[model samples]
Target chain A: MKELWELFSVFFRIGAFTFGGGYAMLPIIQREVVEKRGWASDEEVIDYYAIGQSTPGIIAVNTATFIGYKKKGLIGAIFATLGMISPSLVIITIIASSFMHFKDNQTVQHAFAGIRVAVVALVVNAVVRMWKKSVKDLVGIILFILAFLVIAFTRISPIIIIFVSAATGILLSYRGAVKE
Target chain B: MIYLYLYFEYFKIGLFAIGGGLATIPFLQELIQKYGWVTSQELVDMIAISESTPGPIGVNMATYVGFQTAGIGGAVIATLGLVTPSVIVIVIIAHYFMRFAEEPLVKAGFYGLRPAVTGLIAAAGFEVARVSLFNLQEYLDTRKILDIFDLKAIVLFGILMFVTNKYKKHPIIYLIAAGVVGVIFKFG
Candidate 1:
C-alpha cells in the first residue's frame, strides 16, 4: 500500500508538470522514474518507451502502466495510471467549466478566433513532421495519399482505412516487397 | 445512458489512436460530425487549450468533451473511457513485449500503421484548416468566391504558418501570441 501511494504521487508530479504529450512526457518520466526513484534502469526505461509508443492509447498512460506493473503488479498499474491522469482530470474540468461561462464574452470570442487559426498552423506543422517521419517509401506514400483522400472525400470511417493499411503493410512485408 | 455512450465512444478512441494525443483528432472529428456535441470552432479551441495546458492531450480532450456533455461526473467517465484501454493493453504488452518487440508481424504492422495514421492526421488537419480559414455559411448564402475567405483569419494563418515553421518554439508560445493578436485585431 505504501509503495502504491508512492507510485501514484510520483506519477502525479510528472503528469502535473509536463507540457504537451507523449514524447514531451518521456524526459520527465525518465528523470522521475529512472534517475530519482531508481525504479527502472535507463535501458529498461527505453524498452518500456518502445512498447509504450507502439501499443494503443496515450503513450504516457501506457508507459506508466508498464512501469507500475513492473514494480507492483496490476493494482499498481491502476494506481500509477490514475495518478498520471488525475491532474488532467482536475485541470481540464475546471477550465472547461469556466470557459463555458466566458464563451459569450466578446473579448474571449476574439481571442479564441485567433487561437483557432494558430491551432491550424499547429496542425499543419504536425502533418509535416508526421510525413517526414512516417511516409518514407513508395508504399508509405501511397498509403498516405489513399488514407487522406478516402477519409476526406468520402464519409467512410477512419477505422476502415487504418485496418486496410495495416493489412497492406503485413502483406507487403510477407511478399518481400518491403523488408520492414 | 449518455454516460455509458460517452465511455464506449471514447473507449473506441483509446483503442484506435495508436500514436499519441494528436492522433486522437481524427476520431474526435468523427464524433463532432456524428453527434453535434461540439462545433468545428469549438474543436479548434479545444485543441488550442489542450495543447497549451499540461498533461496528455488525449486525456484533456476526453475530459473537455465529457464535461461539455455531462458535467463533472461525465468528465471522470470519459477520461476513464480513454485510459481504460491503455491500462489493459499496456499491462498485457509489458508481459510479452520483449519477445514481440522484434517480431516481424509487429514491425510490419506498425510500418503500415505509421503512414496511415499520418494520412489520417493530414486529413484531419485539412478539415481544421478549412474550418478555421473559411466562411462556408456566407459563401453558401452569397455564392461569391470572395465570401469564402475570411481575410483576417487567412492573414493570421499565413503569418502564423510562416513564423511557427521558422521559429519552431513551444506550441504554448504560438498559442499565446495568436490569442493576443486576435484580441488586438478583434477578429470576432
Candidate 2:
C-alpha cells in the first residue's frame, strides 16, 4: 500500500508538472523513476519508453502504467495511472470552467504564446536527447530520417510508420546476423 | 446516454492513437465532424490550451471535450474512457510479454523502433516550432517573407535553448521564465 501510494504521488507530480506531453516528460521521469526511486534501471526505462511509444494511448500514461505494473502488479498499475492523470483532471476542470472568461484576455494569450514557444524548445531538447541515445548506426539514421520526413510532410498515420520501422529493424538485424 | 457516448468515442480514440498525445488530434477532428460536439475553431482552442497546460495532451483534450459536452462528470468519464484501453493493453503485455525483452526478434523490433520513435518526436518538435516561430498560413496567403517569422518568439526560443543547453535546469523553470517574458513583452 505504501509503495502504491508512492508510485501514485510520483506519477502525479510528473503529470502535474510536465508540459508539452509525453516526450517532454522523459527527463523528469528518468530522474524520478530511475534515479530517485531506483524502481527501474536506465535501460529498463528506455525499453518502457520504446514500448510506450509503440503502443496505443498517451505515451506518458502508458509509461506510468508500465512502471507501475512492474513495481506492484495490477493494483499498482491502477494507482499509478490514476495518479498520473489526477492533476490534469483537476486542472483541466478548473480551466474549462473559467476558460471562456480568459479566452480573450491579453495577458493570458501572451502567456500562452510564450509557453508555446518554450514548449517547442523543450520538444527540441527531447529530440536531441533521444537522437543521441537512439541513432547509433546507418540503419538507425536512415529510419530516423524516413520517419521524420513521412510524419512531417505526409498524412500517413504514425502507427504505420512505427510498424514499418519495426519490420525494417527485424529484417536488417536478421540479415546482419546471417552475414556474420 | 451521453456518458456512454463519451466513453465509446474516447475508447476508440485510446485504442487507436498510437505514438502519443498529439496523435489523437486526427481522431478528435473526426469526432468534431461526426458529432459536432465542438466546432473546428473550438477544437483549435482546445488543442492550444491542452498543449500549453500541464499533463498529456491526449488526456487534457479528452477532459476539455468531455467538460464541454457533458460537464464534470462527463470529463471524468471521458478521461476514464481514454485510459481504459491503455490499462487493459499494458496489463496484457505486462503479464504475457515482459519476459520477451531478451528475445532476438523483439530486440530487433525495438532496435528499429527506437530510431523511429526519435524521428516521430523530431517531427512533433518541428510541428511545434512551425507553429511557434512561423506564421505559415499568413505567409502562404500574402507571399510576404517578412510576415513568415515571429522574430520575438524566435529570439525567446534561441535564448531558452542556449540556457537549457548550458545549465540543464529543470524544464519547469524554463517554462515559467518564458511565461513571464511573454507577459512582460506582450507577445502575441
- lDDT at A17 for candidate 2? 72
- Tens digits of per-residue lDDT, candidate 2, B37-144, equal 999999999998898788999999999999999999999999999999999999889766688877888888878888888888788778878887889888999999
Query: Could you say which candidate leads in DockQ?
Result: 2
Interface RMSD of 1: 5.9
Question: Model 2, A1-180: lDDT tens per residue?
Answer: 789999999999889877777766776776688768898875566667667877889988998998899999988989999999999999999999999776768887788778778878877877777678777788889989999999899989777877898898789887873111
* Candidate 1 error regions (>4 Å): A1-88, A95-100, B1-78, B94-98
In candidate 1, what are the lDDT values of residues B1-188, reduced to their tens digit?
Answer: 98998999999999998867878999999999898888989899899788756688888999999999899998999999999999999888777764585788867766787777667656766675676689999899999999999899999999988997788565657766888998999974
* Candidate 1, A1-180: lDDT as tens digits: 999999999889777755546545544564578767899865455445445656789878888898999889889999999999999998898889788665467776787677767767776676666567677699989998998899778977655776688788889898987664
RMSD of 1: 7.4
- The complex in candidate 2 yields a DockQ of 0.66
Best prediction by lDDT: 2
DockQ of every model listed?
0.43, 0.66
lDDT of 1 at B163: 93
